[model samples]
Target: MTMDWCPGIREACAHWQNATMLQHTFDALQMALESDSDASIDAVKGLVECICRVIIDQLDDPTSPLKPKDEASITEWVSAAIRVLGRGDVRDRKFADLIKHHNGLAESLRVLRNDAGPFSHGKDGFIQALTIYHRRAAILAADALVTFLYKAYLDSQLDPISSREPWERFAEGNALIDAHVGLVVDDDDSTTLRFILPSGDELPINIEVSRLLYQLDREAYVEALNAARGAQKPAQVREQGEH
Candidate 1:
């Protein structure tokens, strides 16, 4: 059943942009960047920090799904930035470099998620534990994106006269399909270990990967939880009817 569950995490991540809390942060970041009266690059850094903080906060919630809509939130901000900063302002070489770095980070996150195994069978408890592991992995990727974006903004501030049109187009195209498809051999190995074992005389061969098992256990949990909740709901309805 765990194998059957499609990871809806991507969708959940996309939803934050529409959420009030995250939308306000994006608005503030946009306003700060648009008011470009100062040469200080701190505004750019502030934007990166705000984005990273929102994502980290969302990920901290164990029940949250990773939704593509959550990603759309960031993309929406990027689109708005293009309008405010102007296409040329974002297309500079420095901005290109920054986009490259953030793209790599986004790829890394995909790799880690792919390797983490599915949560179809895994219940909320198992997912909660896995969430702990994922946050550690996500932090590195998030940091790289934030730092690169800040630096790019700083570079733009220094060379406001530079041409950014080419790079802006390039970054927009890159962001769309920029994905990490790393070969997760370790995950494959874990699968083999889970389903296969070596046998020898006078020796016990047991393949154990606790994390994988924990994830599998979640499927068992979700099913039971759903069943229990379903049972309780009917009883509640009956009591209400009697009253």
Candidate 2:
């Protein structure tokens, strides 16, 4: 039931002074979840709207043709954010298609919010109330969209040098190293060294503990090991003397 992306989203919003608003919205959502009310649906929609507006306002590129108007819909804001983060790269068909799909999803969420959200519109007739399952679905969708857009925004802020991995930067600095190498750290803490190919593919090799050790400064590594042993010797001697 936890929003795993809340911390990162709060961190991102901190710069814009939207942390208080985000917290209030989250608190309202939590209350709705506990009450099992349709207000959870409204909160989900409001959360997305809030994040989309933040992104549209802060990350909009003036030169980009995809920029949204001053009074744009939630879907338009989402699309504008995506376009700005993606650099309006229409050349990448895969990226274009993905953006299209995401924009559609945003639009669908907007429609759902209007139709199912109790507080969105006043109606004389009785409306069908959304169950916990619907709330969960909406929450998951909003989480995915907001997380993806925010991550893209953060990545777009990185410079070329900062975007490259450390070893890639080292390789770029070294004239003798003809190949560009990158490192990927897995969730389980295992490391893989990848040779980045010209076609953008990678040849990955799992780095063992011994190999990783040798990758560091050999002299410093040995000195640290000796220092550890030297320190342990005093403890061992003290134990024997005490015995």
Question: Model 1: what TM-score?
Answer: 0.25
Each model's number of backbone clashes? 27, 0
TM-score of each: 0.25, 0.54
Error of 1 at 199 (Å): 93
**lDDT tens digits by residue: candidate 2, 63-180:** 6556567667778777777766764576788877777777777787777777777676765214486666776777667767777777777555533443322344344345443655
lDDT against the true structure, per candidate, is: 0.40, 0.66
Q: Weakest 10 consecutive residues, lDDT, candidate 1?
A: 1-10
User: What does each candidate score in C-alpha RMSD?
Assistant: 23.2, 12.5
Please report the candidate that would top lDDT against the real structure: 2
Q: The CA-based lDDT of model 1 is what?
A: 0.40
Model 1 misplacement above 4 A: 1-98, 107-126, 131-133, 158-243
- Candidate 1's displacement at residue 40, Å, is 29
Once model 1 is optimally superposed onto the true structure by TM-score, how far is the C-alpha of residue 227 displaced, in angstroms?
74
